[model samples]
Target: MNVPTEHLLILSAILFAIGMGGFLLRRNMIVVLMSIELMLNAANLAFLAGARQHSAQAGHWVAEGPVMVTFVIAVAAVEAAVGLALVIAFYRRKQTVSLDRLSPTGATSKAN
Candidate 1:
């Protein structure tokens, strides 16, 4: 299907805004990680929108967007895995996943 680039960009912007809000406002580590993922998806959508628009204008196949998207997805997956692992470790050490409970160094207390 041929969707308008403007609409796609608008959607991406909205998603990114929401993600940024969640990341900044939420105290839960898991929620913050999810917000990051949402932001990443928003970026992917923007990339696809640009690629589609370029393809339509040039009347040819373009692989740049899709290729970049693939790399983004891979990187996102790794980010998620590492983030979740860290969250788990944090919870195990602190008994809570709330960011507010963490100290300036991100630990529950002095490591000492």
Candidate 2:
């Protein structure tokens, strides 16, 4: 059974919007990181949808989309690792994950 490509794209768009909203509105470092991940997953959905649509039209799927998605997932994993490490280090120094509480140097500062 095949699903409609437009539906997948719509879902992807929705996920990306929600992720952007969370990233912009949330103050916690971890939540921001999670929003970034959600955006990445939305991109993956778009890639898969494109691949499926291509397969439907051409009678065979190209490996490009899935291969690119694999690379994206790898990059996302690395991003999450580095982001979490920074968040942990910041929390260790400032005792808070709130972005508003952090200074440019990752230290605590008076909120303006």
Number of the top-ranking candidate, with lDDT as the measure: 1
lDDT of 1 at 31: 97
Model 1, position 81: C-alpha lDDT score: 100
* lDDT (Cα, 0-100) at 24 in candidate 1: 98
- Cα lDDT, model 1, residue 22: 100
Listed per candidate, the RMSD to the true structure in angstroms reads 2.3, 1.6
Q: Candidate 1 at 106: error in angstroms?
A: 4.7
- Highest TM-score among the candidates is held by which one? 1
lDDT of 2 by residue, 1-112 (tens): 5678999999999999999999999998999999999999999999999998997899987888999999999999999999999999887877888888777674346654
lDDT of 1 at 32: 98
The local distance difference test score of each candidate is 0.93, 0.92
lDDT per residue, candidate 1, 3-101, as tens digits? 789999999999999999999999999999999999999999999999999999999968899999999999999999999999999888888899877
Decoy 2 TM-score against native: 0.92
